[model samples]
Every structure is written in C-alpha cells, then in structure tokens.
Target: MSAQESCLSLIKYFLFVFNLFFFVLGSLIFCFGIWILIDKTSFVSFVGLSFLPLQIWSKVLAVSGILTMGLALLGCVGALKELRCLLSLYFGMLLLLFATQITLGILISTQRVRVERSVQDIVKKTIQNYHADPEDTVAEESWDYVQFQLRCCGWHSPQDWFQVLILRGNESEAHRVPCSCYNSSSANDSAVFDKMIFPQLSRLSPLARPGPSTDLCVVSAKSHIYREGCAQSLQKWLHNNLISIVGVCLGISLFELGFMTLSIFLCRNLDYVYDRLARYR
Candidate 1:
C-alpha cells in the first residue's frame, strides 16, 4: 500500500478502537441504570432524590448510556465501511451529545448551592420517616444498609430515630433502635438493646416496669450509633471522587472531538470510484 493508503488504514483502525471503548462504556452505564431502576433493595434511595432532573440518577445514566452506544455504533460502522453519509450522521450526533454535556456541566456548576441544600433536605426527610424493615420498603432497607455500612445513625445524629413513632413510646415495635445502630458483631444479638425484657417484667409490678424505658435507652444509644449524617458523608465521597469524575469527562470530550475530526477528514478525502471498485474485487 502507498503511504497515503497506510495512513488512512491507521486512522480507520484507530477510530474502530475508539468507538469500541465507547461501546463498552455505554453498555456498562446502560446496565447500571437498568439495575438501579429495577433494584428492590433501595440501597441508592438513602442518598436522597433531589436537585437533578427526573429525581433519579439511574434513569439519566441509562439514557446517556443508550445515546452513547447508539452514536458509537454509527461511528464504528462509518469508519469500517468508509461511508460518507454514515460518518456525517455520526458527527452530527456526537456534536449534539457534546453540547448536552457542556450544558449539564454549566448548570451543575452554577447551581451548586441549590443542589447541596436539596440533598440535605431530602436526607432529612428520609430520616424522619426512617424504618428498619429491610424486607418491606426500599427506603427502610436502604436506611438500614447505610446506617450499618457507615456505622452511623440518623441523618445528622442518633436522635433522629426518635422521630419515628414506632421507636418512641408507641406500643407497636417498642424498645428497638434499628439493628444497624449496633456494631456488626453484636448487631444480630437482640439482647443488647432489648428494653422491655427486664428481669422485673415477670413480676408485673408497676414500680418494676418503670416508665418509657425506650426514651432513656435510646439516649444511651447515641454513644454507639453513628454521629455523622449521610449528607456529610456523601459530600466527602463526591469530593474524594472528583478527580476520577473529571478525568472521565475530559476523556469522553476528547474522544468525541477526535471522532468528529477523523470522520470529516475521511469524508473529504475519500475516492468514491476506488472505494466502490475495491469492494467488488
């Protein structure tokens, strides 16, 4: 092959590799989104749904993934087949995707405070209604998981558990302050936090029974439960992962830009007669 032909071949293969990476990345994102949408564990609900559009990050990720994969497929096909029309379509779609990303970045940067406040508000609300029924609601299971994993209680403090009616003076599920509040080793042993099973309970004496033992018991729990809130933890997590996030964004931007340039070059320089004859032979 001539020098020009060799160079064109290199560019074509490079684009193939590029689109392949995007295709894989897009597939992962799409799968993750579907998992979040269908997930019954509610593990993600503890982070609070607010600030972002649609109130669900999973859906957003899923849609973005689909778009990325679709455009990437076009790019792969265009480069491999050396089709000017497909290349043009790929370029246009990439441009649109790039613009959308830029707009989203700007919006997030400008409304940082609102987003933070929204997170705080949502977390607080979830805590107020918090329940530890993992088998039941997603919110409850998620909260239990978070508290257990983080070794923390409540949104801002352990006292947040009191906000729940059943945990308080209510006769329903009394004397229990979520198994998550306890350390993992002792979490399953109900003997630790059991308030109503006092030795005097068998006596049935009013003096021995005492009054609202849960109120004082939960107060002592403040010592064992997590002191930090999920909002604060989430903030730290974002800060810690900021570098990776920025790197991914920059990488995607550069990839799209390269795809656009390469597609344009191939379109402008392609020899229609030679390409047609080569295909037949």
Candidate 2:
C-alpha cells in the first residue's frame, strides 16, 4: 500500500475502534435501563406511575443505546466500503449526538438547584408514606433497603417517624421503629426486629433485660441510625464526586469531538483512496 493508502487504513481502524467503544457503552446503558424497568425490588417500582420521569429517562437510555449500536454498524460499513453516502450519514448522526449532549449539559447546569429541590421534596414525601399502606410491599421493601444500606431512618431524623405515628394515631404502630434502625452489627439481627413485636415487647418490661440491655437498645439504635437525612447525604455525595462526574462528561465530549474530526477528514480523503485502488486494478 502507498503512504496515502496506509494513512486511510489507519484512520478507518481508528473509526472502527471509536465506534466499537460507543457500541459497548451503549449496550451497557441499555441493559441497565432494562434492569431498572423490570427489577421489582428497586425503589423505582414502588412509586409506579407517579415516578414517570425516571421511567421515561430509562426508556430514553435504552433507545439511545440501540441507536448507538446501529450507528457503530453504519460507521464500520462506511469505513470498510469507502461509501460516500454512508460516511455522510455517519457524520450527520455524530453531529446530532454532539449537539444533544451539549444541550443536556447546559440544561443540567442551569436547572441544578431546581432539580435538587424537587428530588428532596419527593424523598420527604416518600419517607412520610414509607408504610402508609400495608399492601404496598414494594414501597416498604424499597425503604427498608434504603435505610439498611444508608443507615438512615426517616427523612431528616428518627423523629420523622414519631410525627407520622402521632398523626396516624395507631396504637399498634405507636412504638414501632424500622428494624433498619437497630444497632446490631449483623443484618440478620435487624431483620429479626423488623416486625412490630419489638415495640410491644418494650412496653411489657421497659427495663434493661440484662443480655443486650433492652432499655438501652433504643439509644443504641438511634446512634446507629444516621443523623443526617438521605437528601443531605445525597448532597454530600454529589459534592464529593463532582470531580469524577465532570471528568467523565469531559471525556465523553472529547471522545465525540475526536471521532467527528476523523470522520470529516476521512470523507475528504475517501476519493483519493478509491482512485488509487482503481489505478491498481
């Protein structure tokens, strides 16, 4: 192969590699979206239709993933076949994808505060109704997972549960606290106490039971239950991971820009390669 032919071949290989990365990334995103949709154990399932935004976002991810894979195939064929029309279409799609990402980034930056507030409101309301209906096993189990994983009780504090119990005026549920609030080192211990029996048992004696000190259990449990709410924890997490998040976005944007430049260059030089091959024939 001549110098020009070799350069074109290298560019074609780069395009294939770049698109292949996107194909894999898109597939992973698509699979995650599918899991989010079908996984009944997740918090998303609890809210059902009320959580329309998340559901819609998941659908978008799945569709975008499929489109990305298709684009990868188009790019591969164009590079290999040296087809002008296919290359043009691939370039156009890349431009569209770039624009969409930039617009999404801008919108997120501008509306971040509003988005955060809305999320917090949703979280508060969800916690308030953590166990509103006994039939809602989905929501209840979801909350249980959150509390156990985050080591948190209610929205702001355990007092949130107290307020709800007062408003509910249900004697049976009065002293009930989520098993996740327990200080036990083992999850099994907490699981065992998740039932409503603890409150009744405490009422029976209300004194130290020697073995684990039942009277002190509430205090210890409160100690284990995170004092900061989920919203607050989320805020801290975002702050801490801001650098990583920005880096990932920047990497994606740069990756797209690089491929776009390569595609344009290839389109310009495609004819030269074809002419050289024609002469060889």
Candidate 3:
C-alpha cells in the first residue's frame, strides 16, 4: 500500500476511537445533568428556578452533552464511510461548535467580575426571602445547602444575616446565624427556632411560604458559624475552578483542530490513493 493509503487508513481508525471517547464523555456529562436535576436527596434539587446560573447548569450540561455526542457520532461515521460529503458536513458542525465554545469562553472571561457580582446579587435576593415565608421550605433548604456545600454564610458576610428579619426583632442582640452555617446536621434541630422567624418576616418580604421542619434534634456544641461569606467563597471557588474549566475547553479545542486537520489530509489523499490503486490494476 502507498504511504497515502496507509495514512488514510490510520486516520480513519484514529478518528473512530477518539470520537468514541468523546461520545462517552458526553454521555457521562449528560447523565450527570439528569441526575442532579431529578435528585431528591441532594441540595442541588432544591435550588429554585430563580437561582440565577444554578438552575441553568443541568439544562446546559444536558444540551451541550447531547450536541457533543452528536458531533462525535457524525465524525465517526464520516471517517468510517470515507464519504467526502459526510466528512464535509462533519467539519461544518465541528466548526460551528468550536466557534460557539470560543465565543462563550470569551464572554465568560471578559465578564468574569460582572458574572460573580451578578451571582452574589441573586444570592442576596435569596437571602431576603430566607425565612420570609413559613411555607418556603425549599428556599430555606436550598440556602442551607449552599452554606453547607460552599462552607460559607450570608451573602456578603456572616453579619449580613443581621439585615434579615431573623435578627431584627426587639431583642436586637446575640450574633446568631441560620444553624446551617455552623453545621448542616443541626438544621432540623434549629427549625423550630426558625419557624418562629417566618411569622416575623411574613409582613416584610412578599414571597410564598414552606413546609414545617419535623424530627427535632438537640443542638450539639459547635464552635462558630462559617466565618467567610458565601459570596467570597463562591468567588474563590470560581477562580480555582476556572483553571480546570479553561483547561478542558482548551484541550477540546485542540482536539477539534487536530481532527479537522486529519480530516482534510484524509480527504485530499483519498483520490491520490485511488489513482495509485488504478495504476497497479
């Protein structure tokens, strides 16, 4: 076999395998999105649709994963069939996806600070409704989960809760936070105390209400509420994670570029290989 034929054969096999891996990765991400969306035991499930970017996560993951898998399958079929038209279509779709990824990356990078601030604003709004309604158990559970997972309290600082009605009664003293800040396990134990707060806030925030917390347990001796603000913790977490996130995007972009290059070479050589075989015949 000519070198061109050998190279074409190699490229075909390589694309098939690489795209298979891509499809699998896409599947994992898609399944994860579905799991988080429907998960009853997890804090993520309680995050309301009004939660700014949080609510978008599952849908975004599912949609993007499906698109990636589709692209991978197209590339695999194009390569295996050695059909120039299919290959061209595959290239176009990959190009479109690459452009989208680049555009999103640029937007997120340019708007980093604004994005963080926007998320905090949403959290502040959430805090305003924290205990505002006796029936808002989901919102309460969601905030508690945020503090537990992010290991931070309040929107700006632990003291920010002071602005909430929970701290603004005639007592006007004693620095306390939603029990979740100290420890999540004690959340139910602190609910009876929190239920009392909702009635006080009812007149203030114009939000709906929630279910009652049962199975009261005794509070254990814990040191303190989380000293850091969730906003800052969230900012730091985003900063740290941004590295891996960028790395993955960069890696996928490079893969797409490589695949496109391989595809072009494979297409160009097809005719040459066929011509060589005709001469041998």
Candidate 4:
C-alpha cells in the first residue's frame, strides 16, 4: 500500500475504535436518563419530591436530561455511519441540547429571585400579624430592620430570607398552625414565645454574630428558644440541596460536550477516508 493508503487505513481503524467508545458512552447516558424518568428508586425521584412545592424545577431538569440523552444517541449512530442526512440531524439535536440547558438555567435563576422576594413578603406579613395593630410603630421598626438586614445579606428581592423561615415553621408545626394565627401575633401570643419563635429565626440566620443575634431577637421574640445545634442542621440541609442541583447541571453539560466532540472527530475521519478512496479510483 502507498503511504497515503496506509494513512487512510490507520485513520479508519482509529475511527472504528472511537466510534465504539462513543456508542457505549451515548448508550449509557441515554439509558440512565430513561431510568431517571421512570425509576422511583432513583435519587432524582427521591430528592425531587422532598422539595414538595419546589418539585417543578426538578421535573424540568429530569425532562431536559432525557431529551439530551436521546439526541446524543442518535448523533453517535449518525457519526459512525457517515450519512450526510444523519449528520444534519445530529447537529440539530446538538442545538436542541444547548437550548434546553439555556432555558433551564434561566428558569433556575428566575426562580431564585422569586424565592427571595417571597421570603421578604412573608417576613413583613408575619410581623404585621404579630403587632396589636398592623400599623403599630414597634412593628414597623422591627419589619424595617429585618428587611434591611436581609437585603444587606445579599438578598436583592423585595422578599428575602423569610421563605426559609416560613418553611422551617411549617415543618415544625407539621402544618397544624391554625390558618388565622399562622402569620399573626395571635399565634405568637397563644404559643410559648420561646417554642414558636426562636427556632425559626435561628434557622434563618445561623451565621449572625452577637449584634445580629440581638437583631434577630427584636425581629422574632421567640428567637432564643432553640438549641444551638438546630442552626447547624438547617444550614447543612440547605447546603446539600444546593450542591445536588449544581452537580446535576454540571454532569449534563459535560456529557453533551463529550458527545459533540466525538461526533466531530468521527465525521472528519470519514471525510478523510472518502477522499483517499477517490484518489485510488
């Protein structure tokens, strides 16, 4: 065989090896995605439902992964066959994958903003409900201080850390807090101040120092009731949830990147082979 022919043969062998690897990777990703969609035992299924009202976000992510994996498998097959039509389809699939990620990213960012705003609103309403009169000067001062400190702590929305506080309360009360007293001072008055207030406030801002702790007390009269340990538990729970979501997004990005790179390499190899064959003819 001529030098050119030898090179072409080598290229074909390399392409075959790369294609095999790509097929395996694509298949694994596609199957795993399907499993995530249907398998109740999957981590995505469990963690997703744990968020209850926030499960919508997790469902979006799972659907995105399924679509990406399906496209990736099709691309791998098209690259191996060197069919121009399949190649075009593969590119379209890649575009879809890119678009899905962009959409999910935007949604997540917007939801984060919404959550922050809702938090602030809850705090203001809670304080209002606690005062003898919603327009009381003491209540107004307390609400302003709480809102200001929350904004200072990097919460940019009209609402702030109040969502987390409310969630903590709901969990503790087991949803038993009466609707009338749920966001009001009557609930605070009826329950022991220490039991009802301190636990929620401590969970909201465990990182606060002495002055901030005093501020927390002003904002929530029952602030001192919780044991110091509850703060760490709440912090750890939040950290773990955030980490899991980040990890899922990163993994999907990496898988799409690898599939596209491999597809390009295979197409170039096929082109090189076709050119060499024409020369020999």
Clashing pairs in 1: 152-226, 153-226
lDDT of each: 0.65, 0.65, 0.68, 0.46
lDDT for 108 in candidate 1 is 91
**Cα RMSD (angstroms) for every candidate in the order listed:** 10.7, 10.1, 7.5, 14.1
lDDT of 3 by residue, 159-269 (tens): 767666654545645545665566434453545335433443342233534444332111222334577888788778878998897788889899888988887777777
Off by over 4 Å in 1: 1-5, 24-68, 131-136, 140-151, 169-177, 185-223, 271-281
TM-score of 3: 0.67
Q: Lowest summed-lDDT stretch of 10 residues in model 3?
A: 213-222
TM-score of each: 0.63, 0.65, 0.67, 0.38
TM-score ranking, best first: 3, 2, 1, 4
Instruction: Write model 4 residue lDDT over 1-281, tens digit each, in one string.
Output: 66755654454355446545655665566555555445423442344221121223335555655554555456545655566566566666766776799787888677977865676566546443533342333433444333332222112322222343432354454211111112234334534334434443342343534331122222232332122222233345567788887888888677666655555655555666688779889
Provide the clashing-pair count of each candidate structure. 2, 0, 6, 9
Candidate 2 weakest lDDT stretch, 10 residues: 212-221
Model 1 Cα lDDT, one tens digit per residue, 1-281: 66777777788888878898888999999988887666523423434321112225578889989988998888888989988899899888878888999999998999999987886676676666654442233455456656656667676766667667656655553344655566535445555434412331322233444342222223235334456666666667778999999999999899778888988877776784377569889
Candidate 3 ranges with C-alpha deviation above 4 Å: 31-61, 131-144, 166-176, 184-223, 238-243, 273-281
Ranking by lDDT: 3, 1, 2, 4
Error of 1 at 187 (Å): 7.9
